[model samples]
Target: MITNDAMTVQDQRTSKIILAIAAITILLATFAGKMPSGMIGALGIMVITGFILNYIGDRTPIINQFFGGGAIVVIFGSAYLFHSSIFPASAEQNVTTFMKSGGFLAFYVASLVTGSIFGMDTQTLKKAALKYIPVILGSAFFACLFTGLVGMLVSKSFYDSVMLIALPIMGGGMGAGAVPLVEIMSGKTGMNAETLMSQMVPALAIGNAIAIVMAGLLNKLGQVAPNLTGNGQLIRGQKAIEEEDQSTAPLNVTTLGVGALLAVTMYFVGTLLSSVIDMHTYALMILSIALIKVSGIMPTALEQAAHSWYKFVVGNLTPALLVGIGVAYTDLNQILAALSPMYFLLVLITVLGAVFGAGLIGWMMGFYPIEAAITGGLCMANMGGTGDVAVLAASKRMELMPFAQISSRIGGAFMLILATMVVQAIA
Candidate 1:
């Protein structure tokens, strides 16, 4: 009979050889400028790269401690990798298309949203929905106020700073937040949208990077000061937290399929409702899910299945999704180009202001300060859905995804309306 220890050694050797072969293949394709194309090629590369970089980030000294560990590496590392000349341009385009047009990001987020909301206590869901918006409002108020003051001191243009820089940075991502704001400003000020976009994109990029870093720092803070954070729970001293079922049900393939169906169907419903309503599709989806949970309409087995499917996606696909985000959304070049002492300072203050405002208000409403700052503040400051994923991943608080989506979708819409009013007032 073969010894167990010898068998283990042989298995390890086989794994190493396989990894080495894969690495060599990737290198050869890179130098030859002949990376495979289409979904198969793009997804394969992203998954391999994500896993390798994630491993390195987790093992590296100091990086795993202060930074976001593997999460940061998978994102920023992939950003640099995709942007470098050594990487094939065709490959980059393929990855981008797969991430956006393929609906991979939406699929990932819908699963998280549905699962997290369904898994929560019904009463907790009700209380969080009622109080979360106020936290977002608080975050926006402080972020704008701080950015405006600093802009006046540095550039002597408070209106420009508040309108151009602060609003866009806190308004969500480029498409939903900055684009609409620019068009509204164009109508009021007679300036071209292109010119306004040029001015705002840098701030948005830098702000997103800052928010990601802050998320990592906040995660470290939670480790040192557990009292300030509720771990993943937003509410403090809630019975829901105490009563959470620690023993999860065994994995059921059929149940997971049912969960996937429910999640996608809910997203479809959101899309339909959005066509008739003025709200964003994501916002409508969140509201619909929350209502379903509150109404006790969904069966217990289905809810558990949704939660189970969520766990599976987060475990297996998160690194791959981060790779996609790095390739599609993160623009390190833009961030570097916009870096100045004064500009960096203003962006940092704006993010900090958001954290402070949300934390303070959330505490008053019986939510944990760190959790509130992350979901309510950083989510708003980041680059919308992609940013939400990166920030939440860095913070190691994927369970709070439902709240993060609320900040991005609903809060983003509010910023658009606020921008319209501000433009009408100033113009």
Candidate 2:
């Protein structure tokens, strides 16, 4: 009982206990047809549970890590298991009903507004924007161009399939951009939008699982790869960046609040403009950024809001989206069974291509290995949406979380514009 391994044993026991509690609670809720708000309650529980576990873990490192990982596995694994059992009755109907419920629209609007308001700077923020605006704009432009070209070559039908694949990637990875793309393709091509979306819901869930595994593997690879480079020269730039970051002032609450407000304002403004101008969402995003910058409001507010918004989107909204998907899981075997091979192939190609390309480009740009990997994820998410990017972004330990946020927003805006233009051209 007093052995050195006692702690390990206790940790395992604690993890199992938490997992069991979660599994049972989820099962009861799901089976009783009482799963609250289309898995919204479930997602909230997961987050709250995760936070509790994390807090407990902080006190006991071994237990913390064990339960942290175990809790997630249990929650998701159990949800999937429970969902599968009850899926036969009305998967199609359930998913369609949820989609039409407009949960996603609300989530998107909230995220956009919150992100815009929180993304802005409060103090001397405008100056920061002037400094970083070019870099952000340039990145967005290229990312859009790249995503558009690739999305076009892949075929409209393929785009539809990729959208499906992108969803799970987003759900698990926090990639939101994929959903809109899927919707756009469905609307433009007269495809079976609901059926396609239903097929994607499961794919996204699977993608989320895969993204977790991939993130771990990539993180390991990043750690080991740097060792191969000559001693000293390998991480000079990275070290320099880190040192530079350390010297900068830390973000404060008022600044953060102001940023959130600005991001929120921008979201509504952008939405309004989109409805009136009939332009692509990405175009609207870029226009919003431009207006915010030129309005003498200081780009920093947007930047800060963007940062806060990213956290909120990833931590809160993203999980809610997943729950939405879970609620939509009614069991549509017949529809999924009818999916063409081309559709599957297109999805696989687009995801792999985007991931690989983003990584390569990030690496070429001299970004840290983790940053590069995130960039790859962002590329996929941006091309697809937030769900995919969040998955990729989550894979790495970032030195600066804000960079990932800005990169995602900028990249997504660019991709949206590019995708829309491509669709328009083909039409």
> Which candidate comes out best when scored by TM-score?
1
- What's model 2's lDDT at 409? 55
* Tens-place lDDT digits, model 2, residues 1-427: 4776998898899998997787677546645666565435445444443344333433554322322232233334334533565422333234334544644533443454344323333222233334333333433334334433555676754344334453333322223455665566677766776775666655544443444344444544555686422111112244443233223333567655665565556556767887988654444654566555447565443455455545555554443343333344222343355356554444444345444554554445444434444434533333233333323333423222333344455555455555566566665
Name the lDDT value of residue 270 in candidate 1.
Answer: 91
Overall local distance difference test of candidate 2: 0.44
Q: Which tens-of-lDDT digit does each residue in 1-427 have in candidate 1? A: 8899999999999999998898779757755767777777778778888899899998988778878889999999999998895577877888899999989899999999998888888888888889889999999999999988989889648888888888898898898999999999999999888989988999899989889888988899999999999888899976456246413634788978988998899899899999999888888999999999999988878888888888889998999899999999988989999898888888888899889989999999899999999999999999999999999999999989999999998888888999999889889
Error of 2 at 109 (Å): 9.1
**lDDT for every model?**
0.89, 0.44
In model 1, the clashing pairs are: none
Name the top lDDT candidate. Answer: 1
**TM-score for all predictions?**
0.94, 0.50
